[model samples]
Target: MSGPVTLPAILARRAAATPHAEALVIDGVRVDYRTLHERVQSAAARMVAAGVQHGEHVGVLMGNSVDWVVLFYAAASIGAVTVPVNTRFKLDELNYCLKQGDVRVLFYVDTFLNIDYTQLLRDVEPAFDAALPGEVLPLLRRAVIVGDVAGHDARAIPAGVERFDALPDTPEWRAEAAARAQRVSPEDILLIQYTSGTTSFPKGVLLRHRNMLMNAAASALRIGVQPDDRYFSVRPFFHVAGTTMSLLVALVTGACLLSVPSFDVANVLTMLDEERCTLTSGNDTIFLMMMGHPEFRRERIHLRGGWAAAGPEIMQKIHDVMGVKYMVGAYGQSEASPNVVLNDWRDPLELRVAGWAAPHPGLEIRTVSQETGEVQPANAPGEIQVRGWSVMKGYYNKPQETAKAFSDDGWLRTGDLGVIDADGRMRMLGRLKDVFRVGGENVAPAEVEETLFSHPAVQLAQVVGVPDARLGEVAAAFVVLRPGTQASSEELIAWCKSRCANFKVPRYLQLVLSFDEIGMTGSSKVQKNKLRDYAIREFGLA
Candidate 1:
């Protein structure tokens, strides 16, 4: 049956249809659909009592928990936009997002992952204790702490901050929340998802309720998700892969979501085996880490299927080594509500593992020449452009960027290079901006990384272009060897040089412990832009 277009309506429908079914599972704590619905209602009422209004942004700065889920849906129910703050952000980054996102109310934890969020907030606004709304963050008035704040002398709940458990949930506020939900339209902005700022400051991508709801349902349908399925996902909720693809997928399909506050490989492997999850999701880095972990046992894992945004080698590993036979590859950015292209689980294994897939239903995908404005034919590489139900409304508060993000004809410029086959399946080449020229030879970092990944000792490889005197730009790579295995710079470069073109081989290769030294997004993506800067400094090119 075609479900409701709005999140609140879908939650209500699921609650009514399967009141006793488990909807969320975290740290052995389970929340059923009915209870989840009630919690969201109470949270929505609290939002109303706190003076949150329709169309205003409510920032969520907590880890993945029942509180995060409740606050997210609560804001949505009241027609307020949820701006999920990156949990890894420092004081400056946090300040920028809160200010740029125009967050009027914020729901955060006092402490998470050993980071003092209360102190960070104080750093963002020095007078946070003095007033409800600080001078630094003019729009932010209401601050609610969600997680445990007791039993720690250093971590005291700040003054004037409301506790999540202390929020008023009266009948009058409930009525107002329900009335607000009724007024919410599918076209209303549901989230202002901030992009991972790899190159520059992150822009808030405006996504509507319809865009997210449709994408989630489509993803769940593609994976053949069942109500009894226990889907395990370590992808953080701050990202779209976690929100629309994981959480909303569970909500729409009545499946149970297995969530974690952080990525602990040993704990995740244990949970995946103990809980007997039917489905799971992650990118290349996550899958690699799991397989490389000593605790990973293929026989113990009973996954049926899940989606990934990975390369061909990693996809193959996820299928063969990990025993996720139905693992499908996907391609997307935050601009398209994150899942523009996805592989159907029913498709052939090779196609599913090919790191290329068909576009979502009703999503129009086309390839246009980056040099020229003309469209390209099938099998020709060009800029991937999309115009569809899943495309975001625009970048929030960035009129020039929003206007530049799309073509004059209204198609969203993905800034990714890809080729659409005759069968209409798209193979992503690489990011348009990431492609570099070495002595007039164009090099896509994916092409180089693919060669490096084939090496037996290499666990993960991230390649970026670095400035050079003669060639203008040359490839620089950071290699992460398997846990017990080791590969030297000269050795891996030789392996790549033997397989790839001369210019495509990394001119400078650095062996690293992990992407942590460089930095990775919550979704496990290596920030290429940051790596590039690091390389420039390391090689003294700066």
Candidate 2:
């Protein structure tokens, strides 16, 4: 069924069927399927001219933009792997992602946030010159900066990167890209999303074209997407939810996607009102932002359902307040191409928040003991194991970790604890590992603790998730400050924002005098549950 349903094929078929129909609207620019498909083809040809080979990783570092979508499909058109770099990544995080993904060609905004990405690279690797593909790093040969020549710093692009418009645009190049795009197969590896794990660094989840296409189709159908729906998207394109769910779903169903560079409450409300969008898909953070905004009550907008995982009360409030009856919740990780288990919009509100989700077609789920591989009885909680077509092949270049991720018979241990009833309805309990979700983004304790440990005044640090009213959960830190070093909680909290992603920054920090204040196991691992209890009492997080 997925043989010819590749990412490029989705766009091609959509363009053929609705050549003049609206395809994407972002940053005040509207593009139709015919024009969008043409630009994607042109960009693909540029990638070919730039020497991006099949299986080669192409890094995209930019905010949500029409160009970002163009570059993504362009890379897909030529069978080059598209590696979406997190725009929030600082120098260290960005450097690691580039190296880890082994990106050969990079496309980034010329000047963003007053700092040039290429200059940042040059600061780290002074030899980072890439006038052409494979120019500087071990695998990174070329850099393409997306910008208008008339823009500031256009003439001042740090050595070796070409302007976005400088790429070839002739009919000959377009034809070449068209021919090459035709050769891309559904089984080809299309995306490498770098997601952090409980371990220190992030791993590249290798998703084939079919894995993404089917996953998007299934999830959209499960959520009851209507063909005439206009989707409002605020999530970053780097995340699977943005591309696979928001962008691809619109294409799959002939829906129009209305996007913004980032979430602005005013802009979101404006889009919701102006576009009369039938649905809006993003994390809990977006829903919270919209509901909390001052103009929230003053606005009169009608829509269907899209927000998910907000517990029962909030879900009910959204249904009543937003007038979106079908908006529902969903669950899945990046390895499963994002969503294998999804909640039905038509189901009762209680069932949705209870995590009563139906697995996608061909997706198999089982609960098993984390210590022993024994399968648990119905409704018993342990680790949730999933396997099927949507599951990724493996982590790129990390065979050992990939092997450890699955069992001998090939069940992917999801590291999450959940219960499955006899009816096959699953209730997500919590994480078996210290990893937890904060505003829908995974926050591994180690990742947050590692950033805190870098502080000079911090002797030891442990992060645990605590209940919150707005965000479903937030990271709270228990810190053992150095005896002589005097540091305020505010200072340490501010320090964390610089080192880690904004979401991973601890919201509540407790300064303790000694080790006995924390519950530690005999082997010296901090008792994570006790920390959660302490957070509730000390910070009043609950």
Candidate 3:
């Protein structure tokens, strides 16, 4: 914590302190810190040798693997900004990320049916074969393939395409890259994480090393993660919550990080038991999956603590069943380096209250009425606003959108509607955009959604406003049932009525196989806009 506290520095410090300890676990591959550090240094050297410079953007289009983590740390070591392109994204999404971040180099895994990087590059660069040798690619320069490259011919290599194996490990190169990395300031831009907005385009959330480190430090402190604690990370590294709060926090705190390529409930359960993982974090879906898992008996997993962001009932259920010693319920967004408010472990009631703002020294939180813009007193629901060190620099390249998120005084308008209680805890009511008028009575969908999740048959639920001539707007519930379990619409409606205010109950319930096709951002929050559109289209409310 002494010098310029960059990510590379943290990795280096951890490597120095515990070189032989396991740094990453993926696909049965265990990489010790010594090996992980060396791999990062070697990759950084290759990147520099390939002409990547400080402040330049390096696009990483790979799945959750050691290669992805290596490239991320490699870029950070050289002061190059890492842009983690979602592997699930199609060609259009990949192209947008490349253009939006102005990515100069791309490190990608070989093309799969789910994502065709070769086809995407072809679309981005039409004249690939005729380009001059050593010519810099404006859209994307170097295309380094992660796995085997035997089938890909020279013609398909484009101008500057390189294989990951071609990058050799050399001491001189490692020293030079490490020396360069040492100069990186905490204020330097570390990552650009894309989050989907109400529009079709995803916004690039810009986060600096300082912002991320501060947030991680705060989260680590909040969770009380000790050096001996082993934290499991099933959340993808591309997400702000997973990368900074989970992975980086482990690195900075001298803790072990056991990462999985994806969330397989059974695999996660096994790992929690096998690794003795003390901490974990995920959204409601993950918690529900764990609770519903056939083998999820309390005695099987030895979890000391973890964090969750879900409804109050789900939180209570997790507490009751999981035997998690310290579970924090958090709320935040990618724009604020993800964690703005979190329920403290000190009080179980804090989980029931609105999330408290992060222990960000300079951060401020306020509530203002949506209709009047008047500041609301304690317990009165209003729009939540925040200004803090943890806030992102801005949405990358979208000056207009960035401006819209802030007020004249520079407080970030969170777009979430909530109330600050007299005790200084802020309770989130729902998203301002998610609230609807039902027969002139304001209805918050989150209220209904949470109540529905508490239903024994409902595994996951989302509520949206569907147009009704009689009521102006009526609540519609889209539910995903517990595996092999089914509940009728009437039962669900009655369940909601029993738990919540009558006005909050859904008038119509749609038993769906899934919520929406829209994928999760690196963080596991539901893409509500996708759900809203699905409700409009499928229910004929549009």
Candidate with maximal TM-score: 1
- Best prediction by lDDT: 1
Model 1 lDDT per residue over 1-542, tens place: 36458888888899999999999998667899999999999999999999999999999998888788889999999999999999999988899999999999999888888888888888888756776787898888989888677434534566757777777899999999999988888999999999998778899999999999889999888888999999999988999988999999999899999989998999999999999999999888888889988888888899999988888888888888988878888899899988988998999988887766999879999999977889999898899999989999999889999999999999999999899999899989899888999999888899899889889899889999999999999999998899889778999989987887899999999998878878786667888888898999999998
Residue-wise C-alpha lDDT for candidate 3, range 1-542, written one tens digit per residue? 66567988888888898998777777687788899998888899998877889999998886678788889989999999999887677657766888788888888866643556766666665544444122323666667778754446644675546677787657777778978898898889999988854546888989999888888877777777888888887777777767787778887787777877767889889988888888888777888889888878788767766677777777777777787767777877788887777755675644533344343456678889878888889878889888889899998889999999898788889899888877666777788988999878888887887788777888888888888888888888888888878899898888888887776788888887764364444456666677777777877877
Model 3 per-residue lDDT at 390 = 89
Per-model TM-score, in order, reads 0.97, 0.80, 0.93
Ranking by TM-score: 1, 3, 2
Segments in model 3 whose C-alpha atoms lie over 4 Å from true places = 111-114, 127-137, 149-160, 349-359, 516-524
Better of 1 and 3 by TM-score: 1
lDDT (Cα, 0-100) at 169 in candidate 2: 75
10 residues in a row with least lDDT, candidate 1: 150-159
Considering lDDT, which of the candidate structures 1 and 2 is the better prediction for this target? 1
